[model samples]
Target: MTTPAKPTKNFRFVTGNDPDFFKDKKIVSANRSFVMFQQAKKPCDGIDPLKPQPQRVEKASKRCDASRPQPRTASIPAGAVTETPCPPGMSSDDALGLFRGDRRARKRLVDRPQPNQRVLNQILSLKAEDLPFATPNATDMCSFYALLQTEAAQGVLASRGKLTDGQLLFEAAYEGFMSTFPLRVVGSPHDTFEVLPKFKGDFKSSMEELKCHCSATFSCPNLGRTWIPKATSSKLSFLSTLCISAAHLDAMRGERSIWAPLMGQMIPLLRIMTADRTLNTSDQAIISVLQVLLGTMIACQEVSSNIHWQGLAQLVTLRGGLLQLDPVIAMMISIHSVESSILSESPIVPEYLEFLRQRRERSQPGQPIRYSPLYSNQVELMELRHDPYCSHNTYELLCDIYSLTNLISIMRSPIAELKNFQSLDDMEAERQSICARIACLPSAFSGDSKDLSRRARIVRYRFESCRIAALIYSNAILNGCSFSYAASQITPAFASSVKKDPAPRQNGRNTRSDSLPSIYRNRPVTITSYLKQLLARSDTSGLWGPLSGVLLFVALIGGTAARENLPVPTSATDLGTDSYNVKDRSWMAAVAVRCGVQLGFEYQGTMEKTLVALADVTRMSERCDSAVVEGWRASQEPEILEKSLHDGNGSLGNTSAPQTRFTEATTNEIHIERVSEGWPSTTGQADPSSIDWGFLNGI
Candidate 1:
């Protein structure tokens, strides 16, 4: 070592500076004992250690360890690819197939398919019972959040390991929430924001967006005639602020965290305050709590009425219904409550329904009948005498839905870019008007005795079920989102509002209204329970009448929507009182299957086609084939006829193919043909990755 070779620059210890690309790729030797990282210099058959020297250079045999027996050597091929290594594991064809993403690779690596195929093939359920509720995963110490912190806040986060300027993050997140999913009320502009009160003077407040330079501010109606009151934004407390921030984190990054100690402390304080009957909850505090609840729902991406909604309902009940609250607060509760009810299959809130009824009575004084150009045909549905099979208010709601659907369809076309409609305000007003109609109409029959034929009663019952199904259609297909938003803060507070006395407290909790069902005594009624009661009588054989198709649609929707981690009892004795009590996916699918068979549909493809059409949430402009023009022709009744109805250029029905594919459980050879109406029968799905969902936003 002392005689250490005076370092020659060329005589480095490592043979090459650049490591081989395939150096890490492990390959087994012939005996599978030794592993080698060697490239094939030339392709050949096998090795023969004792062979006589040949005239030509010998070929490189398959890699082998000392433990393997040798075979006859073969002549090296001049330009053969690294031949299938004779290690006897993994063929050349198989290696090539893996490199080039193919079905073969997918089959071999069942758990890990090729990247693109792998991602899309996963069956992600929208609503699963077993999927854990969204909880905060991030912490104050996370460097990711440090990016959002101020210098002072960053120092606090570093040294103290606490987030003090969380409001800054919350404000930023509120802006994002407003931009991403601004839940608009009726009479409001599309994709608008909740305006904050930027005070110009003492005791003077206007609907001016504060210093926030958010995109939602640009879209928001800044000055005169705002629908959402400024009070909503102004009253949000730090608790609500953190919640909104958490929701933003949940939506954008799929990661969430909150000030856990603060929350824990606040919960105890809230409990103590709640226990104190003298300490009445103010409107602002209630509003903040509502925001907190709403934020949690958003964070969870909730599509059903779970615990949050139940608590919210109870709080609203304590507050003497939506009317007694500030107008804007009422609107917030109404929108969330109504939409959640529709989604969860719960009964419409009585307060909202009564409010709509009063509005109807008030507007009846001078308002003239008006119909959208696309759905003048549904005007008759408004009259109880027009169709005994239809409920007057529900059918009226359905009629408006059709109009709204057509208007939205037209608005989504290129023609909308030209600004053909009166204005987005008018459209939203129309939608709000529809929301009010949904509120006014009962989701199911009153179960009151009526003078009608046996079949007529059955038909009317089916029609009621169809209305709720249509609500689902509107919530999912039309909105392209689970949440529905309606009711205007500007809607004048009703004079004779329901005023309930504060519930008498006993043993630390307030006594609930005794009139309500026992379900609400514990928790609010779920839509599943309501549906079961609604369908109790319809267990007999009877056509859903003219609305039979709609019933099928509803059944399909219920089945799909109810796909959750439900426990199925294998033994009959274990079938508890709850067994078959809930009309779950199994029940719903059975209903659909039976209906399909009764309707003479022999192919499972028919059901598949129906499900696809139900989920076709694309904009009409993007979906239409060779959409040269927004195809609407003049008609006397409705004033506009969809050219797709008459197959102009290419049928609009062709445009309604689903963006995603669902592999059918059963595929039948049977064909039952009768041209689809505004439904796909001739088109295939779009590329799953290319789906654009911007149409969901009204703007």
Candidate 2:
């Protein structure tokens, strides 16, 4: 502008060279001189080539200058832009465009599936108290068929959703039934699902609906009807048909879609069926139903939660009691046993024992017992009296008793006698055989009959009983206690010789006195005396030594008694009167002395010892009576007189003390002195009124 300033290399004005340059600057110099002058006057003018301006000061001044000018901003025209939401049924892209055109309409539409109007409408239209029962109509059948198809489709879709959404469907179905058919819903779908089989596809929805119906039926108790009976009958009819239809359909599809719903319906239907007696008429069907029910109940979570033995027991006892349902009951008991065994610290051992005891008691004699109750009770009674089963039961019972100390003692008591002695003869023989086997043993086996370590105590008592019986019977025979002839016939030679030996007097020791033969006297004396002494030192210690001594003594005594050639005493008084009565008659004396010694020992020992000793003594006395009777009969003695003495002696042994002596003077006054002194007391005193022995033994 200053003389149209000559074009300058550093300062040239060119149009459209830089668009921002025109906007930034108001004018440009054409000449370099003028440009220099203008630049010099400006604050950005360079004073020297190396010098530079402070950017902070320049920026601050520019900002201050800009602040001085009025603030400006671009304005949007009203017609230039707008926002509008698409129509209600429009796509999202259309709505987005509408939103861009008209902003106010953006809030109108939200993307969400329409409420399941069909299912809701179906539920809303359903009338209370009018459940959808099967009808012989095309329209109703078609609607049900269509509903089934729709449910199957919905279930497929729902299966693809989150598990939480699937659960929501179940809950929604339950709620719908609760709201529409309040009379048909029972407890809760959650509870039902715990017991029901997991259904798939549309069947899952159907199950939910079924559960809802059952719950509704049971909910209204005031409807003049029991829901259990009605529901059971209806379900029985419905499920039977449904199962058949499903089976047919599954056959065609080669799939088991109905299996889930069928299983799901089984438990509740079973409860219904069991509730009505009429529904149980078909034996095979009932059994099948029960089987299915049992399987379901066993598999159910609710069963685990609600399990109780008493309920199971009640079920077993129903209808015909345990006898009629023993198989089922046994299965249940077995299950309980296993469970109790697993969970309990000390399982129900006593209960098992009680069961065995009751079974044994109820069993009759001589019947073929069946393990299975399906057989006649008569068969069981037959078997109970004989053979393998009775013995088997006895063994099992014994094992159970052995497990408990208290039970062992109870079973061991004499009160536990066999119901019939004849019937138990084989068992007794077996027991005796076992005892004999043990006796023959050189050492105690690991499985000894005795339960405690102090076995000698038991053996000692048993040996004492045997000795006492032998002594009493031999004395009665030798003393001629009205049965001398009988005694002579029955007494063995060795026992007779021993009984006739003279007494070893208390006077100056007679080394070679005119006593009985040494063989007869010393051997019996040595053995019996050793046993008595060993038994006298009665302590649990040195058990084997004492037991061995007793066993040896018993063997010698039994061997001598069995020889069958021993002499016999003439009368009871002969036993007391002879100078050798204390020695020749010492066998009886030894018996009495041992009895007294045992009593005294027991009095000094424990209560258990005393009781055991008493029992041993009682058993000995009984055996004595039996032996005396045998000896009397074999000798052809006066039956009446012999019976009296034998019976009297037995009674006396039981009631009187061993230390109580019968004086000779009193014995003679009572006409028993001779017998008491080793002569037959009734040798010369014949009573005509006495019965003859010839007729007694069928002679």
Candidate 3:
């Protein structure tokens, strides 16, 4: 071998004996074999065989010497390059060709649409940026926008025609305004009244103003009225509506803000109306204002203690002082009297009874009469006593007066009954017992007879006062002015003494005896007996017994029938603090009788009658037909039990059937058989066939 000639630097050729050439050839064969093996494998194995392998030949032609090196070639342009020959495991024009042909394959992928085209085009189409400039003038722009909104809202409303949501929204807006801007800078009370009509703005303005005003005012009434009829009337109506709205809004919001403002305005108004005589308002007006004020106060959630309830108390005090200034108004004062007592949670019965006691004492020979500013003149205010309207008005007023007085007395009754206990222990026990009794007392008992009686005495004084008030009002209604009549009713003589009794200098013993009733002389009485008597005798006849006769009885016998058998205890100690006050006893008496009678007769009786009627109907149906009776009887067994025991069964009957079975022979049969067959010999054998057990045993 001419030793294979060395190849030049730029030329190479493969020789049959070369190592790289042999390695290349082996790899090519191995790859071909792998292809064939893959092709022969199942299609499920996911391989293709018989693919051609690319032949690796030296850049130089095969005619070159065996040891020649391959020359390097310049890179081919991507587009100019023809497809590479198939490798041993890959076919020409395979999956790679199809992948390369796809134009999108080499381009960048995006998660969303392109910003410049899709998103920007969509945004431009919306024209959102043009909205602000569409209406350039400030006011005009606002107005136009509002109009559009209003139109939109109206369209919605029209679509849902007659729905409550719109109305509710309107109301809420109105309420919010009233709450915020309660007080306006009106010129005067008259101007304040005038401002009320301005609230009815057009729908759009109304809603906006309402929202603004509610934020501004916060529910306080503007108290500017000077008690002029028109002014007062307007203010009252306005405040009433405002209060109602505030309460409603607060309730809806579940807040308590409205109460503070309402109370603030209401208290001052009540005090001004009650105390201001220069205002020259009628008793009806005064009472009406007071009533409304009180109702509002009660309905409010929070109340301020700063308001002068004490002043209100003095205004309604029956015996003397402020209430005495006007008799017709005094009658109206009874309404407040009851209200104050109830709000104070004090029993009014004792106070009224004490007044009665004092009155009785004053009528005695040696005792001085108690004087009140109300009874100044010997001549009664003719205007108050006999007015035609007075009777009816007094009736209604008395009902409320007595009702509240009775309620207070009942509420304070536990303290009232404590007076009769002997020891502290006993008193405390009784107190607890009373507390328990009061707890057990029906809510219906609050205004019954006993309670009414304590209230009645006060009512009687009120009635007398009303008689005077009615007389005054009648005079005013009839004559248009009754200053002389009003003055006469409050003249010096009448004001100095409540009753006509000579001062107690003549008979000391008789005066002392007549001062308080015999029963109340030395000891306090049990409240129960006093209450019972009061309940039994609260009618008109009992209340309005002749004054002269009562006076005469007190004078001559030194005891008035009114004080005859009060259950007052012997001493102050006996009358423990817990004993029912006269007021409480009176109230309890009234409530007990009223509730006991009404509820006992109406509710219990009606329920019993209903049950009886049902039973009778059921019985009649069962008895009228045999088949029905049998069916009914059968139904009664389990059906009745089922209905009755629907919730749960109680207990079963004693005679219910046994749940188990047992079998056994009697001893008498064996004896009888033995006797019939002749007795067996002791220790001796007996014939087995000789036994007559079957016949003897009667099997």
TM-score of each: 0.27, 0.19, 0.20
For candidate 2, lDDT tens digit of each residue in 1-699?
Answer: 454233333333233345564443122211222333334444455455432233433343345447457445332221221222212354544445454474444573844333344554543443322323221322211222233245554564364443343333333333233122122324434343332224444663354454453343223322114213332333243243234233323322324455445655554544544455554433323333433332222222133213433334444445444445433333224332322221111123334323422431233355222221111123332433343212332222222211221222333467547446663554433332332222121211112333443344343334332333233223332222211222233222122233222556357443332321122223332223323332332331222231222222232232222222223335322222222222222232222222222222221111112223222222333333444444434443456546768778422232111111112221212122231232223211222111111111110
The model with the greatest lDDT is 1
Better of 1 and 2 by TM-score: 1
What is the C-alpha lDDT profile of model 1 across 329-434, one tens digit per residue?
Answer: 5644654444334333344565653443332112234423222112334643344335455555445555665666666665555776777456855665565445
Candidate 3 residues 485-516, lDDT tens each?
A: 11121111111111222335355432223322
lDDT-best of 1 and 3:
1
lDDT of 3: 0.29
Alpha-carbon error at 23 in model 3, in Å? Answer: 99
Q: Give the poorly placed runs of model 1, Cα more than 4 Å off.
A: 1-219, 222-238, 252-280, 300-310, 360-699
Candidate 3 regions with alpha-carbon error over 4 angstroms: 1-254, 257-277, 280-285, 288-296, 299-306, 311-699
Candidates, ranked, lDDT = 1, 2, 3
Best candidate according to TM-score: 1
Candidate 1 lDDT score relative to the true structure: 0.35
